[model samples]
Target chain A: MLTQTVRMLGRLGETVVKGVAEMGFAAVLLGEALFWLAMGRRREQPVRLAPIVAEMTEIGLRALPIVTVLAVTIGIMLAIQGIYTLRMFGAESQVVPGIAFSVVREFAPLITGILVAGRSGSALAARLGTMRINQEVDALQVMGISPVRFLVVPPLVAMLVMVPSLSLWSILVALGGAGVYVSSTLDMTFAAYARQCLEMLTLGDLAHGMGKSFIFAVLITLVGVVNGASVSGGAEGVGRMTTRSVVQAISAIVITDMIFVFLVTR
Target chain B: MNGVDRTSSRVAIEVRDLVTHYGERKILKGVSFDILEGEILVIMGGSGSGKSTLLNHLLGLLRPTSGAIRLLGVDITKAPPREMQALRRKMGVAFQGGALFSSMSVGDNIMLPLREHTRLDRKTMEIMARLKMEVVDLAGFENLMPAELSGGMIKRAALARAIVMDPKLLFCDEPSAGLDPVVASSIDDLILRLRDAMGMTIVVVTHELESAFKIADRILVLDKGEIIGLGSVDEIRNSASERIQNLLHRRTEEVELDADAYLRRLTGEE
Candidate 1:
């Protein structure tokens, strides 16, 4: 029993390490691709651009309402907690900066990315994974289409374009909701909270958070694509990989968020 | 077996010493066959005998480990993606489960390859889709989702999708595996009609002996990744090979009466 437990723990540790490594690799690959795009590696292909645009519209634009609503709700809940905790120390004014920084820098993007991971990322993984299992990937290959170009490239390009936009919207809604909370509960003026938000958050904070969002996007997309491409066996295999991708994506977002915080603080 | 395959044969697909593996288990073991143009080649085997694997290799769905696959005299093993695409445009495949895209309407599924591979406008694509649907006698069922259709309808829809590109070669895997006898036979008849009209080379993989005999221009029996027999239906029927005979004359699970004892009891002359 002791040996089994030890073995289980060892396996768990190895999986976590491997998961982190895969996430790092995915980020590096996306970063390299982004750099390539910057360096004019992306040639003019109007026909290929259409599908990527469609995917961006689907994964990014169509996802706004749900993401905004979820973020606002989280902001309200954070506002309540911020107010309650600040009141205990008689530091009600700090609640403004607290909610502002938390939402813009960490909470909004993290929560929104997690939500999208569970919703959109899982769907992408399942779609591609099932396609892989059902021989559709092979069918695509037989038809002389690279599954990577047809499937992976579209989603990767879409997520890279969408996540930051979604993150920005989430930040706006979260700040707006927190401002309402401040105006009502803390007896603070709306302008005062707005000014405080502007003063407390810097371009660096925005960049840091958006940077994390980009990483999250790449992580989710990569996990989805890799899990999908690696899919074999059958339905159960697809299911397993989809679950793994979503879980891995969300966990990576959290871990990377921590790393971002540590690096920014340092 | 020699240098030149019969030029008189009008070869459509020729696979030479095809070997394929799935992980550790070798699925196809140096299997080779050629399909003549405008003839139905029915591949028969028990479960896991690599019939489906061979079909996949022929269709270019799976790469062979070591073999030459020639389609219409072009070596597909070395064909570029564009060339393979051009080759695939001339062929169609109906998979085992009628793998119509679950996310699309039947009409959309039929029109997908056309839209992707051709520069046709939406109107022309729709017309083409409708024409294929009409050919499959599924004209009005275009708007139905795959999930909304019955098994036989799904099969017909899949067939419509396969032939929408006007393929010269139709590769169907287990065309009648899950359907009832009447529906299966109807599908078989449709295949025959399609072959007759299109002068298409049809390759069907099936273990259904009756279905095989019904539709086969020639049959190849596979066992343990080896071709046990390859001949016309009549040739297979008259084969003196014990394995072939045993397979053809399948013994039922129930006990049979003793012929001499029964005859003596009935007529007092054994």
Candidate 2:
């Protein structure tokens, strides 16, 4: 029994060490990515802008319909739930500011982050994982091209640009959705709802939400690319890495959101 | 073989006591050899004989447990990243599966090395890429993606990509592993042609006896992660080692069984 316990403890230690090592690798990868991008710019041989632009358009445009639908539904749900609960105290006026504050400062960024992580992040991991299995990554290395520079930096740049934009779009659409629902059902005017959102939400709230999305973007890209780059054992490895990338990205977003909320609420 | 290899004893690759391990399992055990300039050296062994591991070591893809690998006069095992990159520009590797980027056309795949490494004009790079395609007999097929091509075509396109930069040292890993006899023979001919035309020092890792005999100026036979034979094909054919002879004759090794031990094993007794 003692030996078994020790063995189990040993396995746990190994897992911890491995996790720490992977995190270190991810940090170093981000540093190398930024360095390579700067170097490429300095040499006037920047990583293809075409791919970065394509990735951005792909992420934002392909996700637009789903993000819109989800945001509107979430906004409407918030209005319905908030009014129903607050009507007990006859505090219906609180619903507008409540929706505005929660949607901007919390729901929009979280929803968009989880969506991007599940959709784009998983795809990124799978693509790079396939490239690894196909030995195209090795071929690039053999040809003196750094795969990190060529395969990674463009997507990293794209995520940094796109995620925050999507977050902003989500915030607006969600607010518009809540305003519509509230104005139609309750005695509130659409303009008054809009005015309450403007009055209640400071620029600090918007920045805070955008900042959270930016971090989430980094987390998703890092998890996807790093998992993809390290994949082994053929096609099965790619599939496993893609799943892990999504899970880790979502978990990272939630944990970061918790921290952000704790700091702000305190 | 005498006239075909115009190699002048220039050691393009020199390995001394190469050793590698995965966790606790030892893979390559003190392998040492020299690949002369402008010659085709075929590394032959059965599955898990460590030829693939050795190839990865030679390519500097894996760090050795111990020993040194000097490629083109640079000790790759100890070379700095900048130096390694400089050395890699002089090397080309065609993997077993061709490994052409699936997203790119064959033409773009061939031109990738040129585009990334050289400041040459796009027109010049295209011409250079086309020239390689013609050399590999893949002319006019450069517009197709890797998935669009047949197996043989993909291998030829990969060869075109490898040779596009005019690398001095070329590595082909199991180049003819999965192909029809006719196509495999053509790939062997292409390897010979590349060596003759470009004066390249080529290292081919393959277990295909027929292809090895066709292209190898020197054959290095590995067994259980150790070098059992390294000589001209004629010398290897006449080798006295039981393993070498067994490999040449395609005969499985026979172990004399002891009845008592067999009975013990059957009875699950120590």
Candidate 3:
């Protein structure tokens, strides 16, 4: 029994140390990428614009339909739940402010981030992992090009630009869904619903939500790129990293969202 | 078996007391050698003989456990990242599997190094890429993806990309590993032509004796993580070592297993 306890403690310590080392490496990679972006501009080696545009299309534009569907469903469900609870207190009209506030300030960005993390983050990790296995990353290195600059920067820039845009799109779709449901069932006009949504929303709320999405974007891309760059063992490695990228990205989004809520709300 | 005089020829690469380990097992054991300028040096070894490990070290892709590797007078084992990057620009590597970017056309693959390192106009880069394609006998196929190329065509295209920058040193790993005899010889011929035309020192790592003998100016034979012989093809051919003879004649090493140990292993007794 004593030996078992000691072995368990040893394993836990090893895992903790490994985790800390991995985090340190990831932070260094992120720092290097940012440094190159800041300094590469003055050197006339700015990140290429073409790949950024392509990645934005892949991560944001192509993701519209699914993000819209998920956001709308979430909005309708929240409205139903809010109405059920508010009707008990004779405050059914309060449901509008409640749904609009929650969707804009929290649900939309969080849900969109989670969905995009699952979709685009896994794709990026698998693609890069396959490239590493194929030795194309080594080829780039031999040619004097940093793989992080060539691969990570484009995705990083695209996520920063697109994730916030995607969150905003999700918020609009959710609001429209809630408005449509309230118009038919609750004695409210779509114009009134829109006005209430706009009235309940402050510039600070919009900025705060968008800021959370931006941070989520950075977290997802960093996780994916780090896992991808470290892949080995051929197809099995790629598959493992792809799964790991999604799990870690979603976990990071949730944890970051909690931290943002605590700080921004305070 | 006349050796090139170290005092007469300039050294392109000088490795001394090199040692490398993966986990607890040593991969390269204190190997030392010098590659002369403008000579084709072939590193020949059987499977698990550390040929690939040494190649990776020479390319500065892997750090040695203990040793020095000087490529064109730059101590790569201790060089900073920026210095290594600059050194990499002066050398080129053709990987075993071609390693082309699947997303890009062959033309873009060849033009990548130029676009990254040179300020040449797009038109000039295109012309240069085309010239390399012609030299590699893959003209007019640049717009096609790497997946569209045959085994031999892929090797040729990768070679074109490697030499497109006119690097001072070139490294080719298993250039003829998976090709037929005819195609393999053609690649060997192309390696010769590239060296003659570009005046670059080349290092090739291969287990194919015929290919090695055809293109090498000097041969280094490695066995079990150590260099057993280093000389011209004729010298290696006439070598009296039983290991070298076995390798040349394709004889498997004879092992006498202890019956007790074999039984224990079979039963997982260790």
Candidate 4:
């Protein structure tokens, strides 16, 4: 019994140590990526533009349909809930501002981050993980190309440019959904709904959501790249890392979102 | 020539007391050797004999646990990233499985090194890639993806990519592992032709005795993470060592297992 307890504790300690080491490695990788982005510019060695545009199309442009559908659904659900509560005090007009505030300042960025994490993050991990397993990453290294600069930078740049754009698009779609709901259910016009939404949404609110999204974009791409680059074993390993990348990216997005909400709201 | 005469030749790779470990298990145990310039050195080993590990160290992909690896006059074992990159530009590696990027066409794959390292125009790069494809007898197959090619074609395309830059040093891992005898012999012939034509030092890691004997100027035999023999093909074939004889004759080592140990192994008792 004593041996069993000690062994369990030993395993727990090993896991903790491994986790810390992985996090340290990830931090170093992020630092190298940032260094390249900042310093590689002045050296006249910008990462190729073709892959960045391709990645943007994959991660952002292709994600519009799903993001639009999800944002609209969330907006309708929020309107239904908010109206039910507001009508109790004859404050149906308050529903528009309430839904708009939540959608613009919180849900839009959070949902878009999570969705992009599931879509693009998993793809980046699986693709890179396969490359790692196939020894193609080593091939790149032996060819005098830094795998980080070649593989990671394009996706990183794409996410940085596209995630915030997706978030803003989600906000507009959600507002449109809420406006439709307001026009049909209550005695409010779409123009009135738009006016209330605009009044409640300050530049601070937009920045707040976008800032969270930009950070989440960085997190998702880094987590994917790190997990992907570290894959071993075989095809099974690639699958395992892809799953881990998606789960970790979504969890990090949520945790970062919470922290941003706390700090920005305060 | 004797060991002294071989060592006197222009040294391309100088490994001394090289040791490597994967975690707690030592994969290479104090192995030492020299690869002469402009010669094909075949590293022959059975499974799990640290051949791949040593190749990784030579390529500067993995650092050794101890000792040094000097490639083309630079101590790559201790070289920084920039220096390593600069040194790597002078070398090329064709991996065991070809390692071609699946997404790219054969032409694009061959052009990758030139595109990354040289300021050659796209047309020039394409023409150069086509020239290499022709050298490998893979001409007119540039538009196909790696998955679309046969096992031999993929290997030939990978060879084309490796030689696209006309590197000073070339490393090939298991160049004839998964192919028919005819295709394998063609690959062997290609290796010889490339060495003669380009005048580059080549290190090939393979377990195929016929291929090793055919193309190698010297054969280094590795067994259980140690160099058991290093000599010319004739010297290795004429070796009196039972291990060398067994490897050449395809004889398996017999093991006498203790009953208790066997039971323990079967029962997961270690």
Q: List TM-scores for all candidates, in order.
A: 0.83, 0.95, 0.95, 0.96
lDDT of 4 by residue, B194-220 (tens): 988888899999999999999998999
Give the per-residue lDDT of model 3 (tens digit) for A1-266: 99789989999999999778878877987897897788876643567889999999999999999999999998888888888899999898889989988999899999999998999999999999999988899898888888888998899999998899999999999989888887777889989989988898899888888999999999989889888988999999999999999999999999989988998788
Docking class of 3: medium
Pick the winner on DockQ between candidates 1 and 2.
2
**Tens digits of per-residue lDDT for model 4 on A149-238?**
788888999999999999999999988987899889999899988988888889988898899989999999988988898898899999
Each candidate structure's count of clashing pairs: 0, 0, 0, 0
Which residue window of length 10 is worst by lDDT in model 4 chain A? A37-46
lDDT of each: 0.81, 0.91, 0.91, 0.91
All candidates: CA RMSD (Å): 8.6, 2.6, 2.3, 2.1
lDDT of 1 by residue, A1-266 (tens): 99789989999999899768865766665664554345422321113677788888889888988998988898898899998998899997888888888888898889878987888899898998887766666655544444555677778888887998899999999999888887988778989889889998889889987988888888788878777766777899989989988987898789988987998788
Per-residue alpha-carbon lDDT of model 1 for B77-163, expressed as tens digits?
Answer: 788755776788898888777777777799988897787777789999999999988888899988888889988888888788788
Write down the C-alpha DockQ for each prediction: 0.21, 0.61, 0.67, 0.69
Q: What is candidate 3's CA lDDT for residue B189?
A: 96
Q: Is candidate 1 or candidate 4 better by lDDT?
A: 4
Q: What global local distance difference test value does model 2 have?
A: 0.91
Docking class of 4: medium
Q: TM-score of chain A for candidate 3?
A: 0.96
Backbone clashes in model 4, listed as residue pairs: none
Which stretches of candidate 4 lie above 4 Å from their native place? A41-45, B1-8, B256-270
lDDT tens per residue, model 2, B1-270: 735444457889999999999788999999999988887999999888999999999998899999999999999999998899889889999999999998889999999988888889999998999999999998998788889998888888989889888899999999998899999999999999999889899999999999999899999999989999999988998999999999888888787889999999999765
